[model samples]
Target: MLWFILIPVLVILLILLISCICIVPQATAYVVEWLGVYQATWPAGLKFKVPFLMRVAKKVSLKEQVVDFKPQPVITRDNVTMQIDTVVFFQVTDAKLFTYGVERPMAAIENLTATTLRNIIGDMELDHTLTSRDIINTKITAILDQATDKWGIKVNRVEVKNIIPPAEIQDAMEKQMKAERQRRESILRAEGEKRSAILVAEGEKESAILRADAVREQRIREAQGEAQAIMEVQTALADSIKLLNEAAPTDKVLAIKSLEALAKVADGKATKLIIPSDMQNLAGMVASIKEMVTDDSAKK
Candidate 1:
């Protein structure tokens, strides 16, 4: 009977001892409370809690986290109302502060983000708001990181996810963009046409220049051919006269040649003939020569 009671008591004590031991995983932190008050933050690995005296209050993650808040209505300086949503990247820096700093840290961050967004939008016009996302993100991140420092929250960065303007404003912007695109297209088409016309004119100019050059070359060739023919005729005539002088013909031969030339002139289509001054003497000479030929034939 004594051995049975001792065994049950020993088992119960072993179970309680095992339950007091806690093992924290990687990238995790455990906030321990002593008598319902802030005590110590246990890091990853094996940890021990005082039985019936200390407890794990909260578990905090040390890794980076992202939270996307819904769109909040904000009024610009120009009184234009717009809806804007944001995403925040954050991490827990101090586990103790993260557990006890605020009632709901995420809710506080969301409210802070919305309030900051409104304040920023309230200072800028709608046009400026639409174009300044980087500036807005930087400002909001700085403000949130500073505000949440006491809560052991580090805001790494903030992003402006979406910005929705009114329906009428969006429609007007679309129409304006369409008109601008059309204007650019028209300008491009006109430039292309201008280039094409210039190319055609240049081609025609080149063709005209080529035609004129060809014509000039042809005329030059014709003039040279004519000059060559005239030079050849003159040279041939000079050679013929030199050959005749070398033969050294007598007066009778000369006279007979002159008579032959006169006969040829008489048979031409001329209306008049110019006889040489020695034509009468030539006729007497011709008669005497004919009488001599008659005497010779009688003797033969």
Candidate 2:
């Protein structure tokens, strides 16, 4: 009977001892309540609790968490209706406050986010709302961070996931975009044609310049050739005159050469010839040459 009693008591004590041991995992916190009231928060690692007196109330995760809310209907200042969805990033900073600060923390946060979004949207026009996502996000994060301080929640960031305008507005926006694209295309085509025309004009101008240069060069070459021919003729005439002087020609021989030149000039189609003032003297010399020739022929 004693052995049975001891074994039952020992088993009961062992069960109680095992129940007192609390091992909290990393990035976790356990909110403890002493006799149904707030007591202490247990961090990660080994912990001991008073048997049957302290109870684990709430387990709070210290890691950052993401919550995506459904799209909420909002009205812009312009009276345009739109649906906007949001995602909130948060982290539990104080385990005790997270457990006891708010009745339903997640529901509270969702409701707060919807209300904040509506207020922000109500102050902005549809166009402004659509274009100002960053401004909206910053404003909401600031408000939520301030509001949720007591709940031991740190609002890390808020994102406006989607903003949907009405179907009619969407259709109008699409048409506007299409028209803008067409205008840009027309402008680009005109610019391309303008550039092409400019290139053609430049090419023609360059071709004209090259042709002018070639013609000018040909004329210069022809003039140079004519000048060289004239110089060569003058040089030959000078050499002939020098040779004649070296040979020491008599006046009769010179007069015979001049008469021969005059006869050649008279053979041309000219109607008249200008005779030199010394022509009479030249005629007398020529007659003398003719007599010498006749005498030489007789002597031979």
Candidate 3:
């Protein structure tokens, strides 16, 4: 009778022990509850639980999670409506808070994200909201982190997935951008042309200066040559005058030279040789003197 009762009690205890020992998966934690109230959160690996009184109420994943938000239409401060979509990357930093702090942490996080986006977009113009995406993402992350910190949630990052403007607004923006690019191109071309003109003008000015210098140098050399020629002529004229002054003023040399000049004129290859009127008297006197000398020699 004792053996039968003992075996039944041992089997019941073994079943209860099996149920109490729980194997939690890696990167996962379980929330324990006693009497349907929050008790404790068990980390991953082997854990124990009260067979029926205390059970694993919930299993909270500690791994990182990605939540993508649907597109939400927001009105900008400039009265333009924009459709924006975003994604939030987060992880359960505190398993205890994740299980009890909020009713649905994912839903709460998504709602907070949408509200924050609307608030941020509402303060800015549509153009700013669309263009400054990085700035908007940073702002959202900062605000979300601060807000969720009390709930033991850490917001890793927030990203603006897309900012879609209305069709008409998109068309207008494209046209405006095209016009701006064209204007910039025109300004750049004009600037390049202006620089080229300035360079050409400067080159011309430098060439003109060089040409003037060359001409001046040429004129200076030409003037130097002319002055040298004039000096040579003046020097020759002075030397001739000096020789004439040094010559003997005697009648013999003059008479000899006069005879020589007369003979050269008489033998000249010309039909007529005109003498100066003043030399006519010298010629007659010379003839008379030569005739007397001839007569005296004949008498001797």
Could you tell me how far off, in angstroms, the CA of residue 214 lies in candidate 2 after the best superposition?
A: 3.3
> Residue-wise lDDT of candidate 1 within 1-300, one digit each (tens)?
999999999999999999899999999999998999888999999998888889999999999999999999999999999999999999999998888899899999999999999999999999999999999999999999999999999999999999999999999989999999999999999999999999999999999999999999999999999999999999998897688789997666566666678899999999999976887897876875576668789999
Worst 10 residues of 2 by lDDT: 277-286
lDDT of 2 by residue, 1-300 (tens): 899999999999999999999999999999999999999999999999998899999999999999999999999999999999999999999999888899999999999999999999999999999999999999999999999999999999999999999999999999999999999999999999999999999999999999999999999999999999999999999999999999999877787788788899899889999888887786798798898789889999
How would you encode candidate 3's per-residue C-alpha lDDT over 1-300 as one tens digit per residue?
A: 899999999999999889888999999988889989888888878888777689787788878788998998899999998899999988887777777789888889988999999999999997688789999999999999988876768899999998889899999989999999999999999999999999999999999999999999999999999999999999997997678669844564456566777889999898998776887778776886687678889999
Candidate 1 ranges beyond 4 A from true positions: 1-7, 194-300
**TM-score winner:** 2
Give candidate 3 misplaced runs (Cα > 4 Å).
1-13, 176-300
Please give the lDDT score at residue 215 for candidate 2: 100
Q: How many clashes (backbone atoms < 3 Å, residues ≥3 apart in a chain or on different chains) does model 3 have?
A: 0
Relative to the true structure, candidate 1 has a C-alpha RMSD (angstroms) of: 7.0
The per-model lDDT (C-alpha) reads 0.93, 0.95, 0.87
CA shift of 150, model 1, Å:
1.4
Better of 1 and 2 by lDDT: 2
